[model samples]
Target: MKALTMARLLIRLFGVVALMTLNSVAARAEIAIAVAGPMTGQNIFRGEQIQQGAQLAVADLNAKGGVLGQRVQLLVGDDACDPEQAVAVARKLATDGVVFVAGHVCSHSSIPASKVYEEEGILMISPASTNPKLTDEGGANVFRVCGRDDQQGLVAGNYLADVWADKSIAILHDNSVYGKGLADETRKQLHKRGVKEAMYASYMPGKSDYAELVSGMRAVAIDVMYFGGYGADAGLILREANNQDFEVQLVGGDSLTTEEFWMVAGPAGEGTLMTFGADPRMNPEAAEVVDQFRAQNFEPGGYTLHTYAAVQAWTQAAEIAGSLDLMAVIKALRTHRFHTVLGEISFDQNGDVTAPGYVWYRWTKGEYVPAK
Candidate 1:
């Protein structure tokens, strides 16, 4: 009787073990996706936007049974906007079997990391890396939901020529890939429009005081300054300019879209002009998603919707292709137009967005609005 009882107990234990193993295998069968960015750096705000956007995208997709009928596993990687760290994050995500990635916001991080995704057969869709070389020089696996610096530069340059033509235009860059590229593009457009800037300079970023630079600009009597850099540095420059009692019209690229600009410059940021894509949150098609974001007490601003749209495009392509193969998705993305928060959009041969470009905005009372 004791031997029989022990045999029955052993059978029950084996059955439990087998069921646990099966559950583990089932969990592993889901498709893995990731969102990577500067999650822990000074630029952590950008990462937060991407992370939140990806979270909603994945959640919404999963609610519909995910792509190809496989549930999606979402992973988050913090590259801190560093090139090497971005590559490391890419590799780690690849090893974890992530087939799709929707991040690496900074152009500096996105370009190098694209090489890794290319080698590892992962698809990457950047939401805010605007440096043209990202798509111009990257593998076919790379794509972006945002407009390029060249496109943004053209819009800014034409505005400068048309509106501030007689002002002594001063163009400045921060020596980073995004900054310099945007400055060069703006300068190029100015030249094309027969406008010559009074001062063109490069400055080191992350410096606290730009009083010396401000004094130099004051000496030149720069009327309008176009800074192709992030918000903090632009704010610092403007603040320094204000300190010297030298008020100038400050303009910047899309990087100034965040409130970080205002938080840094305060009242000095008033009347500052910037170039950004038309706000997607105001889109009629995005009403449901925007409402969903607000229900969580979060505002879907800046690149948040762009990131969401990137995931939307990828998932829609994968769904249409009925597979998650990199080439299949790429083909699907290129050949098909995706209706996203950004509206109907498709990619050109260079993997650049074939959509309409950028528009101008002006800061007033700590917020930005469409500029006339």
Candidate 2:
């Protein structure tokens, strides 16, 4: 009888050890959140911002014991802001079993990557892609945490109409997806406000000389300009306009809200006005995250707040659905209001959040501040 009792106790101890080992394996199993962006090239800073924002989100999630009682992992890919590369990265992320994704920060990158995500039935949330076409593609799986280009354009147009009503304005764009889309929207809104411009011209990106465009504006006596493009073209235009003595108040979208814009445009960017979707410092709930980012010496920009909101939305959806299924999470994300650093967020039918969060900012004293 004693020998039989000893054998039974040993078997029970072995079973317990095996169960603990299985639980350990389950706890370590990774649920990856893929992060894609222009990790190389001229716009690398934008990709860095995306990575920083997502990393910060993952850290915060893990600090709070993570999602579904498992730690979150980030799998990053370099899309380089190229459309084809974006699609490839999306495919790779899908193959890697990445259920939740954040980014492909550029409009050009996000549009194509979104197609891949849609095909794979994977959920993707973009932090910075503002082109209307991204959400207009009719894919329910794709969502944007940032404001659409039309929304941002309206903000810029309203600012011009109210602040520089007496000034003659000209609209310029690089004819790219982001540039042309925003410029056209601004033009429509500006026309509605009866602020007709002196000239509306399309310029090719990376041109060394904008002399003809600048001279045409000079002839028209354009007093204020609304440019729709990235910092490179905007910087060139500012330099060439200055060379031709064409001084005007320049206003643009969130693309101009970067430190690189100021560095490239020099003093010309000093008075430039722009718009951003979310402000991190303004939110009370984001104070701890902001302090944490500053401690790590990371410059969290507009995308940082949006990325945090994306993670929050996903975590909330997971809890609501009680599953890690992508489709269920997407459904929950569309219908449920998720609390974020930017306040409560809920998506409309078009996968764009209906929030009155857009604000106009101007560069003053080396910092971007809203016009009082």
Candidate 3:
């Protein structure tokens, strides 16, 4: 009887140990990834794009058995496009055990957040932070799926100098890192191409009135204007110009790609031109995913597809490396070509995508289409 009781106790103990082991394995089966951006404040649209893209990517990857046989869990961080807030978000993501981050869309936010990611050994892939300093000053762990401001600026400046050279031109900036940096690059390229701007000025962003700036442009008889700012300020400037019966052609950077610009400028936004990567929605490879977004009533415009492609690139790199280890994934990113919705993508040593140069687009009938 005593021997039989001991045998029963040992059997129960083995079953308990097996149950705990299974629970431990189940807990470790999920891999955490993060998407950080300004989920609130003025640039919330961009953050929404980031969130949607990341969420979709996570869902699709999990449905396909995930990466490295582990399910992916996506965590979102709201930096509000503020630098200090971005750092806090980054630290939280690091603490949350995310091995990768796809975010902090604003250059100012990404630059500071990148340092935190570096220290915490988190890999970062920015989908829309274009300021060159993000890569110029960033650690090896940082990468961007978007073109740099310098690249986009060259396209803008040269287009202005070549096509609109006969017209009087003004260059204006909002003085933020992205705005000023892009403005300076465009200015540099214009100067290099022997074009002199009629007016160069800076304006405070987020103001309701830009009538005084319009007055200045009118005074100079500026026929073309290049604005280095987001859609909100750009819309106000255009509306004010239209109110004053000013007919200058408005040109801007990628931030003008959103429908908010049209919402703000109304009919005045009709002729505005901006530079951005060729529309990803028009890509044949993105048809399935684009349809998925449309079915959910989301337009995968602006940086939405870019953010999706960022995750795609990370997944491909991890697969190529055969591991999710930070250094292994970094090595794979540096050396492998990724087949993404953006087409085939490879990274340069600075972690910038090697495909898709910036192209011109013009607003027409409430939408931005490829320029003729």
Number of backbone collisions per candidate, in order?
Answer: 0, 0, 0
Please give the lDDT score for candidate 1. Answer: 0.91
- 163 in model 1: Cα distance from truth in Å? 1.8
Instruction: Give model 1's clash tally.
Output: 0
lDDT of every model, 2 decimals? 0.91, 0.82, 0.92
User: What's model 3's TM-score?
Assistant: 0.94
List pairs with backbone clashes in candidate 3.
Answer: none
lDDT of 1 by residue, 1-372 (tens): 999999999999999999999998887769899999989876777788889999999999999998888889899999988898999999999999899999889899999999999999999999999999999899999999999998999988998999888889999998888899999999999999999999999998889989888998899999999998888888889888888899899988888887778899999999998999998988998999999999999878789999999999999999989889899999999999999998999998888888777988899998888888
Rank ordering of all candidates by lDDT, starting from the highest: 3, 1, 2
Model 1 residue 86 distance off true place after TM-score fit, in angstroms: 1.0
- Which candidate achieves the best lDDT against the true structure? 3
lDDT of 2 by residue, 1-372 (tens): 999999999999999999999987874576788778888866777777778888888988888888888788889999988788888899999988788888878888889889888888888888889999999984888888889988888877787788778888899998778888999888888888988877898888777788888888888899898999887678778878888777988888888776667766777777887888657667887888888888998767657777778888888898898878888887888788988877777998789987776787877765778755
For model 3, the stretches where C-alpha displacement exceeds 4 angstroms are 1-24
Model 1: what TM-score? 0.93
Candidate 1 runs further than 4 Å off? 1-24
Q: List residue ranges in candidate 2 displaced over 4 A.
A: 1-28
